[model samples]
Target: MVTLTMDGRKIEAPEGATLLKAANSANIEIPQLCSNEELEHYGACRLCVVEITHKNRTRIVASCIYEVAEGLEVNTRSERVLNVRKLVIELLLARNPRHPSLLKIAEDLGVKKSRFEAEIKGCILCGQCIRTCREVVGVSAIGYEGRGINKRVATPFEESPPDCIACGSCHFVCPVDVIPMKEKDGVRNIWKTDFPLQKCESCGRYFAPVKQLEYFREQYNLPPEQFSKCTHCR
Candidate 1:
């Protein structure tokens, strides 16, 4: 366990836990965008910055990736931290102003507008989808292309991903709500590809993508009849 003083409140966190996790456990509200409990720590959004003092040296760092330390003094809402958060929020707003998630963070930071030109990419490039697809979904179907101003996530050569299992993990994990996963007529569509939905044997209803269930069955080495029914029916 590590005890840290955050905003003058002494809080205890498990060893090696990030400050963001610790703050969450202690009910200390900290704004974040590129953070998900199921995914690995990725300091991409830079909205969760905090001021920290240790050994008489004070510096600002992203709380989502910075681990807590014993006797460390932290300030989640210091002047410098707030300023940094406002800048990050402003940039994110420029990228995706219509997204309600980003707007709420901007409102919390008191960022009314952005100095940069508005570009509605619908994506903030938070890397959540890429991480979810690679780490959780176990298929590196999508990844970043280009660099700097031209950087964006796309399938290989902008073609339909052949390795994708239509799991919808990336769709659910995307914080910006940019990735669209549509299902109709027992057909699942995402990333410009269509997948047939599986019918639950017990309920006679389409539940999930057939490829996703097949992938699970193959990975888990389950019996052929195990996934005949959907989770609800099972």
Candidate 2:
């Protein structure tokens, strides 16, 4: 454990823990996006910036990825940190003005309106979906495209990649809910591809995507007749 001062409160945190983890251990609230405990710490959103003083030098760094060090003095709510965080929220607001989470965070950060303009439709480009797809799902079906303002997440060529198993992993991880996966009637639409949902053999309720069940079948080497029924029915 390493002792550090966070927001003037002395705290002890496990050594080598990220500052975000340290702050969280101390119950110090730091605004964040593009970070999840289950995924790698990506400092994409720049919302968790904090003021850190070490060896007489004060600098701002993203706490989600910055490791805590001994004798470090961290200020999570300093004016400089607050200003940078607000600016980050402003940019995220510009990119996703109507995102519910973004709107709520912007309001909490005292950001009322964006000074910048964007044609954003939901995605903040935080890469949670991308990371989750690759890391957790082991399917690199989705990825980022272009650069800067032109940058966006999409299947290669903006078309559904064939490797997509219709698992909807991207849907659950998307912060702004831009992956466009939906279920209606008995069809599961993901990206630009629609997969017929399989109904439970016993309950007659649509439960799983056909493509996803097929993928599972291939993974487990199951016979086609086996997955005809959903997990509940089987």
Candidate 3:
């Protein structure tokens, strides 16, 4: 265990826990958008920046990825930290101008509107979908393409990803509803790829995707009859 001072309150956290997790445990409101508890702590979004003074040296770091240290004095809402967080909100607002989440964060930070030109691409490049697909779903079907302002999440060669299972994990994890996916006619479409749904014999309902079932079978060595029914019916 490690103890730290966050926002003038002494808090204790488990060893190797990041400042964000510790702050969360203490109910400290450190605004963050590009982080999820189920996923690894990535400092892609700098909104969680906090001023920390350790050994009389102070610096700002993304709380989500910065590990909590013993005797660390942290200021989560310092003027410098607020400035950094507000600026990050503005930048994300520019990318997805009308996104409700971004707008709410801006409101909380006293950022009424962004000064930058609006792109309205609806993707803040938080890498949530990419990370979810790679880390949780175990299929790196989509990834960043290009660099700087041109960078975006896309499939290989902007073509249909052959390895995608149409499981909707990326879509489910996306903070912004940018990853377009639809299911109809027993087919699930995502990443410009179509996957047929498997019918459950017991319920006669289109439940799981056939490709995802095949992937589970391959990865877990499950029997073919295991996927014959959906979880609700099995």
Candidate 4:
């Protein structure tokens, strides 16, 4: 176990655990995005920055990816750390002023406004959706395109990607709620493509995307009628 002090509270955690993990183990709250316990640590979101002191030196680092070391002192709420985090929140707010999730985080961080001009207006481009799609869903359908001021996420050639299973993984993982998706009249629309909804045979209610069902059917060699009923009905 590695022992560390977070905000002056000593904590013992498993070796190689991240500082964020240590802080969380001690019930120390640190705001973050692009972080999921089930996924690999991605420091794209700068919200988890914390000031650490070791060997008479102090520096700020992203706690989500910073490994905890014995005898290290971590100040999660330091003034410098708060300033950095507030600046990050302000920039995020500037980019996505209307996003509810972003607004909520900004409010929690006491960032009521942004000094920067709005550009792009939404989609902080944290890549949570892209990483979740690639790492968890095993689909490399969506990815970042362009660079610098033109950088953004899009399907291949900015067109409907053939590999997209319409499983809603990207939509579910997006922090800014920018992934386009809507369900209506037993159809699911995503990224300018509409997939028919499959109704549960037993309940007569839409339960799964038709393309997703077909993908499963082909992958598992199941008959067309096999998964007509949803998991609940099965």
Highest TM-score, which number?
A: 3
Of 1 and 4, which scores higher on lDDT? 1
Model 3: residues >4 Å from true position, as ranges? none
lDDT by residue for model 1 (128-201), tens:
99999988889889999999989999999999998899999889888888999999999999999999999999
- Residue 6 shift from truth in candidate 4, angstroms: 0.8
Off by over 4 Å in 1: 232-234
Error of 2 at 163 (Å): 1.2
lDDT digits (tens) for residues 59-79 of candidate 3: 999999999889899999989
* Over 4 Å off, model 4: 218-224
In model 2, how large is the Cα lDDT of residue 53?
95
TM-score of every model? Answer: 0.94, 0.93, 0.96, 0.93
Q: After superposition, how far is residue 123 of candidate 2 from its true place, in Å?
A: 1.3
Model 4's alpha-carbon lDDT is 0.87
Model 3 steric clash pairs: none
Best candidate (score: lDDT): 1
RMSD of each: 1.5, 1.7, 1.2, 1.7
Model 2 TM-score on a 0 to 1 scale: 0.93
Candidate 4 lDDT by residue in tens digits, 32-141: 98788778888987999999997899999999999989889999999999999999988888788888888888888888888788775478878888888888877778
